[model samples]
Target: MDKSGNMIDKMLTQNGLVYKIPNKVAAKQGPAFLQKQRSGSVAYTQGVAAEQQACHWLEQDGWTVLLRRARTHRGEIDIVASKAAVLCFVEVKKRRSIEEALVSLQPAQQRRLFRAAECLLQKHPYWQYEEMRFDLFVFDNAGKMERLEDILRQM
Candidate 1:
């Protein structure tokens, strides 16, 4: 721990009470992060709705969803599904068109998603035997759904 953190621990142990010293940078950035974190008030509500729609559709399509919104230090995976020994990691995006939605998932983002998937698999060894696949769920402007299976096949 840092010197300040050690000092805080020492003072708390001595006094049998703890007082927090707020981080100035964190305090300055907190409101924006808090606003984004609000479940009902976040600007990402549309994206969340789209992901929910995709999850429902996946269930209907006979996929066993294992995780939703799984995260790692690298990035977040929207959904994880499995069927017949195949594990799918999904990316859900809503845009005006299928092309636009697919384009939105940039190459850099794809790498991060892959890294996140690796992290999840490492944490759960039971999943190691399954064949991993990357899939995309694109919600079009007309409220239509398009599923692109095995997206990373081209990668």
Candidate 2:
């Protein structure tokens, strides 16, 4: 078969026509795509590890973690924990340094977290608590963790 005929055959499958990139095209773009994929995977892994460590710390401190990686229509909450009669919505940040992690949470993100917490409270009326607060948990690359209580009130 000619080159065009062979290409057409490669694109066809039992289910339907599938667009298969020719080797030449893939070879030209594969390196950049692979690099991005690797970086994204690394970031995701690090974030998960940080969250796990944060949860462990909370548990050790006699806090019950109600949720981790909670999703709402407004935004995502990293952690939701309770101690005594207080409920906390926590935002976790891991960076090269504690300073970097502290600065990572911007005003816009704070607003989003507040909205997400409100959504969560409305969705689950059974979560009884005398007080609710927003907390910031920052972690450095060296495994140091710092918890800032009532972060919104501090601001």
Error of 2 at 41 (Å): 1.2
RMSD of each: 7.5, 5.2
| Candidate 1 per-residue C-alpha lDDT over 97-140 given as tens digits, one digit per residue, 9 for 90 to 100 | 88889789888888898899889988777774447889999987
lDDT of each: 0.81, 0.86
Candidate 2 TM-score versus the reference: 0.81
Q: Give the alpha carbon lDDT tens digit for every residue of 1-155 in model 2.
A: 23344422245455776775455544454558768889889878999999998899999999999999999999999999999999999888988999999999999998899889889999889998999999888988899999999889534
Q: Model 1, residue 113: displacement in angstroms?
A: 1.0
Q: How many clashes in each structure?
A: 0, 0
Candidate 1 lDDT at 41 equals: 59
